[model samples]
Target chain A: MTEAVDDATLVQMFETMALVAATDDALRAAISAGSATLAYYSPRGQEAVAAGFAAALRPDDYLVTTYRGLHDQIAKGVPLRPLLAEMLGKAEGTGRGKGGPMHVSWPDVGLMLTTGVVGSGLPIAAGLAWAAARQGEGRVTVASFGDGATNIGAFHEAANLAAVWGLPVIFLCQNNGYGEHTAFADHLRVDHVAQRAAAYGMPGVTVDGNDPVAVHDAVSVAVARARAGEGPTLVEAVTYRLFGHVFGDRMTYVDPKELEAAWKREPVTRFRQTLVEWGLLSEADAAAIEERSATTAAATLAEVLELPEPGADEVLTDVVAPAGADATKRTARAATKVVVPDGSVEVSVRSAITLALDEALESDGRVVLLGEDISDSGVFGVTKGLAAKHGADRVRDTPISEQAIVGAAVGAALGGLRPVAEVMFMDFLGLCLDQLANHAAKLRYMSGGLTPVPMVLRTAVGGGLQVGAQHSQMLEAWLTHVPGLKVVVPSTPSDARGLMAACIADEDPCVFIEQVLLLSRKGVIDSTPIELGVADIKRPGADVTVVTYGRQVHQALAVADALTSKGVEVEVLDLRSLVPLDEAAVLESVGRTRRAVILHEAVVTGGFGAELAAGISEALFGRLVAPVLRVGALPAPLPYARGLERLALPGPERLLEALEWVMAYEG
Target chain B: MLLRLPKIGMEMTEAVLAGWLVDDGATVVKGQALYEMETDKVTNEIESPAAGRLRRIAQEGMTYQVGDPLAEIDED
Candidate 1:
């Protein structure tokens, strides 16, 4: 009941699959030999889908995949050396040793992004396709996921969006009969995952996943249709997972009889038999293919083993850009302060921010602001005048989609624009974390110094405005935890202006957190230059050092002044930046004062203050006269009531009390 | 030379000069606040451009066209 094709090309496809299987074996061997700590997701029996899709694709078409991407990547022309280097975490890896097995990417060859998360790559692929379509470049996006991802929200959302927009995207589902250890039948109700595509108003097709020719034909048609602006297609290729889910997954549920049938109908062997019968190639040719593949794999493994480790500076350079490029130089020069008249006048922080943006926009053509409700004076009037002055193109008003706002900014940055994306409130950062942490932070390093994303993320933090829990939150610690990101918290209007200017000028991605409570608080703002990693000493003392930042800086300064009157001589240090943190200043100040008190408005549990206290204890143990005391908000949700909120957050009085306790305590 | 406020709105044709900080012929630097004006929602200071002598054309409590010369600066 099936049509049989000729053997020659089928034999070649079989040979390629064999080679891929051998590479997977080599990866497992490399891991067992203790030469590498690799997480190998073997596509032992399910090789037809990869061979089919890869054969259909041109070198220019993009492929974004998930954790089980080894076969697809290799078949799509990724050299074994770099992939092995990545598995080994060597500098020569596809991701420069930063992304191990799961996060492999080859941007040059058009494999834009890859991930370990099951369905997250789908939306990203849709975005890339959208960009390519807007450029009219005729590049198609191929995103592959497993049967498990069929139920994920991102997969459906991406499918609906792609179909509705008629984007040039191909959604490939390699239904390997199992998601991890669970059988597909137990989880999915439908006989075919492709049948679900009708809901998105797109054509869906089911192919014989074990047959390379069938897969090739289906994918070629989908690719062509996508290129012709026909829309996206979901191709469900029925296959089986031959190996355990991971390196050591136990095969407890697999039936022996079913396994035997799967082995007998193995795609590589069946295709090879079909090829030999049709006289497409001789037996010797197939043997030669196997021999050549082994030799190539061995050579690649040797080359990767010889690659050197990444340097120390490599960890810090790629968050935005390194210091030599034209963009970097321009940013550095712009960061330097120009001579201007100064006076302490009454201006709200919101107004200062608007003025800074206006000045930056007028001064530089590359600077643009994008966000939701930004055109309508923003939520708190921070970007109130921008849209009217710069027009909608520069100050874009986006839909209520945080992910799209951040992702588009990343793409725009790659296209040579400095975008400052505002996420209204800090609490909403959770909605767009993938764009921030994964794409923007990792793109430069993953591309191996090829691309840099210079973007600024401006958001308001703290809880004193009675905007409720959803609006007011001090979530700077979450952003600071990620490497390659620069975190800044400015407490004064002058620092807000200067630091924002510096952030706009820097080549790295920066998260500028402005405390909402301090928007109305007034202070003397000296027009001094503020660098990214430098801490400012607000007051000099001897008994104890009170280290803090953001809204807590004012409280710490007041506490220091109050303690000074009592002859305690407490020093106050305001940490302007969180990442590339001024650890030296903290250590030096704590070492000199012999006692330290860390304060913050964020919750006490796992707050940045805990890290500071631990660092001081580790570095200045012998010099310290007492244990480092941490003063932070109570370990509970911030209350809405003014009095209750005051009780929850650390105030000047609390800092003074903590300083007194640290000053008198004998460890 | 004609002095005008940068394009701040699509429909705004004129703005009222609420107050002036410096007297006529006073030198001003770029980005220095020369006068204050009241918009629909808030009061904002209009900064000066170029270092020169400030010549006030519109007095306080008066309005002028968007691009009309509110003041003239004679470069040294």
Candidate 2:
């Protein structure tokens, strides 16, 4: 522990520790009193780590921490009252109570993100540091996570990438000696988490987390290195969790002797004794702060619990950008009325993405291209020539970590840069879904529109060419299901360019799904811009309406062409945009055609087509000529054989059969 | 010699003569654009194979199949 610290800073650190310990006590009391029922991750013994680490950071510096981040938030200068209100689920809370305790984000104080998912904060910290570097600001980002996080892929990616990119970030590992009651020694093989930092070519330091001054001194070194553009530093604050991981955990698995020893050396009381011995803080002075902090924390918790819950109207307000003048303004900025290329300038989907990404990169200074293989022109040639054209800084190639690729994008977007992160394939989304579903999808609503996550996650979707089960899954339904996300799937090249431009201009998070089959399929792209949430009529007719998107759009068109010879006029509506669903276009087409057929390449059980079918049926329940017919792949993992794959996905033959079924239905 | 549109894709048997890039009877060099063709797969420029005075053999905006000559190039 560093004994050379000044009295004023020591006094400040003592106060921070007292406040956090008081908050922990109040939360336990609230749970006991039945005033609050939310699962709380107590940071009782870990208060010294936050107090010490935060002492060296300025208000403009960023922080990404885990759910056990109340102390970190308090140390970063988040007001105790609003934070307590949030933990109590008050509308006046930091996240307006939408985020609860686990997902608090106070960008105003540089407490950028808090997530419930383990090991996810490191990548997000990397992104904030990257954004700071891009802005030419000397702001350093502190990423605090558990010792268990060191074993995760995101930690490795963040440590390596931040070092390689020279991002100003300090990777803070708060070693609490347990990952949800399992001892650190059992979960991790290394003696100390800091030792792993050497592999990433960064300085590693381990400090006594029980001592506030020691933590502050250690973090100060990292903070200085980062501000000097010396890249990232890894700091492991070895501490113990005196309480259970969550409010109600029985904690029966821990060694009772170790627990007794840790409790005897608890940070708050021990720090007070140290201050008294140094003659800097009198025993009376430390007692008064502890006494006052306890009263405030408990009283605020009780008061905020009585506060009114969020109103029902609050549900729809922050799903996307706020409606009203801003919606109109954003729509004007994003929409470019649909225009076609003058001549048949054929373009494949891959080349179209390359051109669109290039245009997006050229037009906006804030726009950044991030993902794996993007610098290598992408796996399918989608980003060919982009890294060279835009320069390496703008078109960044990241390590093979989906969590970092996505989590960092969310951070970068919140930090003022428009980052477009790619996860290579749709299946890879599983590895990084916490950032996408929990962070990016909820930040706008959670922050009560205070922060806009204006970033795009471009991933390849659908199955074909014999790429088996894991590689060949169409998961647009999962993304479209997330309320805060805008899902876009462009079947044709023109739509790919225009819709991509609109998505980039949109002031919300978007998941842009590109098809593998459409990469080679050539088509004419008009120079005219297309707006989002607008569907295009690929084949106009007055018979059955076939609704589809992405790869299946072409099959619907082929079916319509084949039916043309039989004098059966079938209309195909390519639902290019999924989330801001062009319900009007779908209804208008179906209203004219009278019969509806919804189709997709995903399995029928939980596919996006099911939602479209239900919605179309409800809108035109009595006015329809027949029930909405849905044609999709069977319920099974996509197999490897050509015959099995064909049978698994909806194709021209399947569409033709479904068309005949819908056309013949009299009800 | 007839300057014909080449096959761009296996599925394409015919294509629309989108427009002519050069005037009729104009002297053209090899690789110079004579006209453009829009097939089901992609849009491509039909370049002159030989340097010659070009003569229009087919009208613009007409549907022509593979091996169907669109212009006659007279070597000068």
Which DockQ values do the candidates obtain, in the order shown?
0.00, 0.00
Candidate 2 local lDDT, A1-667, one digit each (tens): 2245678999999999999998887776444322355667889899999999998888999988888999999999988777877776788888787777887878889988887778777888898899998998789999999997888888898788898888899999999998876789899888999999899999999999999999999999898899999999999999999876865454677878988999988999999999999898898999999999988886777688788888888878787885432344234332132223445578787777777777777767788989998988888888888888789899999888888899889889988898999988999999988889888898888877766788999998648868888888888888888889889999878788778877787888899998788888888777576767889998899998999988888888888989989888998899889988999999999988888999888888888888998888888887788888789988999999999898888878888988888778876
Provide the TM-score for each candidate, comma-separated: 0.73, 0.85
Q: Listing every candidate in turn, what is its Cα RMSD in Å to the true structure after a full C-alpha superposition?
A: 27.2, 28.2
Residue clash pairs of candidate 2: A339-A528, A340-A526, A341-A526
> Each candidate: what lDDT?
0.76, 0.83
Question: How would you encode candidate 1's per-residue C-alpha lDDT over B1-76 as one tens digit per residue?
Answer: 3345432323445667789878898887754677776556445565664457888877888875555556777767
Worst ten-residue run, lDDT, model 1 chain A? A332-341
* Candidate 2 wrong stretches, greater than 4 Å: A1-4, A324-344, B1-76
Candidate 1, A1-667: lDDT as tens digits: 1234344446656766877876876665443222444556777778888888877777888788888888888777787888888877888888788777787878667776667877777766766676666567788888889999998766776787678668788999999888877889998999999999998899899998888899988888888899898989999888888765765333567998888889888887777676667677567776677777767776677678678977776676555555444444334334223233257465666666676677677777778887888988887778887888887767877666676567656655654567898887889899888878887777777766555667889988758776667777788778778776888988777777767777777777889987887887654445565667788888888888889888788888776777667888878898988875999999889889999999988888888888898899999888888888888888878888988888887877788777888878877
User: Which lDDT value does model 1 have at A575?
Assistant: 90
Candidate 1 local Cα displacement, residue A505, angstroms: 4.7
